[model samples]
Target: MRLLLVEDDTRLAEFLAQGLAEAGFVVDTVAEAGDAEAALDTVPYDLLILDLGLPDGDGMDLLARLRARGEMLPILVLTARGALADRVSGLNRGADDYVLKPCATEELVARAKALLRRPGGALGAVLILGNLRFDTLAMECAMENRPLDLSRRELAVLETLLRRAGRVVPKRVLEEKVYGFDDSVASNSIEVHISRLRRKLEAEGATVRVHTLRGIGYMLSEEK
Candidate 1:
């Protein structure tokens, strides 16, 4: 999944972005509301983590503006404001959830995952296909109840394919999901990960298969 983090605090932004990336998300961070709004206009992010205070404007206005424009992407507010009224105000402005600052990255990641599981979101806590079972939160995968060992990148690739099970996922979309914007990637990197994933699944006797559509993308489906 891709995430946009709108935070002015450099250290906190780095910490959260690193944590979210480790948890299989591609995160882009912007320090001000203008940059954040620009980023939002271009990227189709799965979630947004916003800080309440910005150098140029209040986060409330940004939240309200997005909601008013019918932007339904899940928004999570991460701020130091813990007052009852502040929380209520955030919810009223269309923030899906609120998290106080000085929080553990683990807790923040967990909360973000929960919001992604809401109705209309692309994620499920656990994704299943044939004999394959993947727990996105735990980052675990199993085939027929036996653990399927995979590298983090491989796991991410599999997760994307599983989520869109029968539909073709474009190669460009896969690249965006598996890598952050700043990361330099080789042209064939996605293919390498897909190749490794296919071998692992075949070796494990999984009933699901990943089919490649040359010049287009890939799809995951159960063998007939």
Candidate 2:
């Protein structure tokens, strides 16, 4: 899943970004509310981790503005403000969840996954198609109950294809979800990932197929 983290503390941002990356999320971080807004305008982020104390403006205003504009993506507020009213206010202002500073990286990852499990979020506990079962929480995939060994990029490509099974997912959309701003992507990167994924599934005798449309995109569906 793609996530946008709005934080100002340099050390903390780096720490959180590392942790989130380990959990299979494509994280793009911005230190100021203005930059955050700009990133939001261009990227279709799956989640937003906002800090209430932004350098340019209040994160609360950004939250409210997103809701006013009908941006329904999940938002998790991470801040140092820990009080009854502060928590309540964050929730009332459209934050899906709130986490105080000094939080454990493990706890933050768990909470983020919980939000993703909710309706309209990008994740589910497990995604299943035919004999292929993907445990999203464990970040593992199996076919016919046998474990499937896949690299990080291959796993991400498989997940995206599985999520949009039976539909043509544009190549551009796949690129956005699998890569962050900091990562250098090659022109044929997405094609390479998908090609590897297709081979793996076919080799495993999977009942599903990954089809490529020339100059269009890719699709996954059960073989008839």
Candidate 3:
């Protein structure tokens, strides 16, 4: 899933980004609250990892604004504050969860998974398109009763398509979903991945179709 991490500490941001990436998350790191806003406006992220202290402003204000605007994005507060009032305040201010700094990476990842497993999040564990099924938590793709061998990028592409099956997913949207804001996506990167995914699905006897509309984008549909 795609996550936006708002952190001001360069070292902490880099460390968390690397760990989260290795854990199969598409993460974008922003050091300031204003940049975080811009990132949110540009990319559709599944969750937010927010540090309360930002360079431009308090992350609390951003959290409140997002909540006021009726955003249901799951937020995990990551900060150095670890007091009863601080924790309570963070929760009361609309954070889904809170984690103090100097904690283990595994614990942070576990909390993230817990949030994603919530009712309105990317949970229920799986998404289905025709004979193809994807286990979101496990990051597994299968056709009928057979497992398909797919690269991480291929899996990411499949997930994006399956999430919006039968609707045209814009190329730009796919790029943001597949690669982070800091990563450079080539002009034909998505097309190349989609082509490889199509072949893999067909090879595994999946009846799902990935259709490309010239100049538009792509759609996943089941063959009748």
Candidate 4:
């Protein structure tokens, strides 16, 4: 899933970004509330992790603005304020969950999964494309009952495609989702990943296809 992490602390941002990426999320991070607001205007992220302490403006303002605009995207508030009143305020302001600072990475990931598991987020952790099935939680994919072992990056790419099955995901979108802001991605990095994924799927005897639209992007669909 794609996530936007709005945090002002550089160290915490880096740590969370790395951990979340390993946990199979495409994470984009912005340190200031302005950038966070701007990012939300452009990208449609699956979830958001917002820190109340921002350099530019209050994170609460950003959350209020998003809620006022009728954006129902899931948001998790991460902050140093652990008081009960603070948690209640955050929830009342539209945050789906609140995580206090010094929180365990595993706890954060678990909360994120629970948020996505809600109705209308995405189907269960298992993604389906034709006869191919992939379990996101287990990081397993199978074709006609045969198991396919895939690298972490390959798994990340495949999950992105499967999540949006039949939709043309733009190359830039895929890059932002997978690499986030920490990695310097080559121009052909996405294509290379897709190529590798296609080979792995085909090798497993799956008839599903990953179609490239040349200048457009890519889509996954059943072979005709």
Give the candidate number with the greatest lDDT: 2
Over 84-129, each residue of candidate 2 has an lDDT whose tens digit, in order, gives 9999999998999999998999999999999999987888889999
- lDDT by residue for model 1 over 70-109, one digit each (tens)? 9999999999999999999999999999999889999988
Off by over 4 Å in 1: none
The lDDT for every candidate, in the order shown, is 0.91, 0.92, 0.89, 0.86
Q: lDDT of model 4 at residue 151? A: 76
Per-residue error (Å), model 3, residue 59:
1.9
Q: Tell me the spans in candidate 2 whose CA falls farther than 4 Å from its real position.
A: none
Q: Cα lDDT for residue 18, model 3?
A: 89
Deviation in Å, model 3, residue 222 alpha carbon: 1.8
Candidate 4 residue runs with Cα over 4 Å from true position: none
Candidate 2 backbone collisions, by pair: none
Ranking, TM-score, top scorer first: 2, 1, 3, 4
Question: lDDT by residue for model 4 over 76-97, one digit each (tens)?
Answer: 9999998999899999999999
Query: What is the descending lDDT order?
Result: 2, 1, 3, 4
Q: Which consecutive 10 residues in model 1 have the weakest lDDT in total? A: 175-184
